[model samples]
Target: MKSGFPSTSPFRLPPWAIRLARRQQNSMAGAADRMRFVIQLALTNVTAQTGGPFGAAVFETKTGRLIAIGVNVVEPTNCSLAHAEVVALANAHANLKQFDLSAPGMPKLTLVTSCEPCAMCYGAILWSGVRNVVCAARGSDAAAIGFDEAPKPKNWVATLEDRGISVTRDLCRDEAIAAFQRYQQTDGRIYNARKGLT
Candidate 1:
């Protein structure tokens, strides 16, 4: 490891990427690398079951590739939208840099999560300046789940645009539902305050 840090291999930092990372370090909630590692860890834990109802996804910013990694299963519930938000925030956090606008290579970051994030997560991502997010839900055909305390749809849409992160969603229904069900069977649980709003 370099300087007691794990190497980010196959994902080298270009000149601009380094600059952007430095700039990002000056602002934001946590170190970009640390946030990204946490997101990956979280996603891994969420998708450990072979037949779980909940699913985790990984987003590639440069290519907009959204891949499913794990799932937490339920009895055919709706949770795609929540998955989308999580991927977006995780991706934005991963892509945080010091000077992306001036970075030469234009290399991108990715976000992966079990489900979409809540409205609050979206706002934080927007404010953080992430521009693209790709997500996968629990089920290929899973509909969006609503929370009793979640924000209105209209507000979510507006704020998403305000943050300037373009979103793309994909369906892997069988795997998603299987994941959710698996989770329930194995007693897997995930909870967050800002998980289903935007």
Candidate 2:
């Protein structure tokens, strides 16, 4: 019998495969349950050293099962693309072993973010194969909290819907806003790239 490639080889299994193999599957009740779970997880990032007051998660739409979670990592590290939604999507892809998230035969998935995705994260969602999105606040809300949000085109939600992605805004608007407020109150750094300009 021929032996497989050695484990010490440079070409090792992907991180997602290892994570999936080691972790237990997470199952939830439904949309409401999953939303609550994601909110709680996202809130924990409110005090993170790098990214504060932003959180996101991925869920299986049909099963209502939690897949992966992520928090913003923009400041303190200067990673412009480390939005909560982007991190969550990356985690989902890693855990599910599906880099091309929308590939055929994949389970239906949803991206739940504490705030509406900015322009970059919006693009990530469109290409991430998640057919549904649940958001706590809109881009304006994040801007209101002192974070610089990129401009979005008119009828953006409609555009996503037209592309077969359903978006549900304001899952818990007040609650989500409260997180940003808390961060602001605690003197959290607001890394606005467009500071000092109109």
Model 2 Cα lDDT, one tens digit per residue, 30-103: 66666665555445555444456877777777876666666676663467777777877876776676677678
Kindly list the per-residue Cα lDDT of model 1 for residues 14-51, writing each as its tens digit: 23323323333221222233234323333333454322
Off by over 4 Å in 2: 1-26, 48-50, 196-198
Global CA lDDT computed for model 2: 0.70
Predicted candidate 1, C-alpha RMSD: 12.0
TM-score, candidate number 1: 0.43
Compared with the true structure, model 2 gives a TM-score of 0.82
Please report how far candidate 1 places residue 163 from its true position, in Å.
3.7
Error of 1 at 130 (Å): 1.9
Relative to the unseen true structure, what is the Cα RMSD of model 2? 6.6
Poorest lDDT segment (10 consecutive residues) of candidate 1: 1-10
What are the lDDT figures for the candidates, one per model? 0.36, 0.70
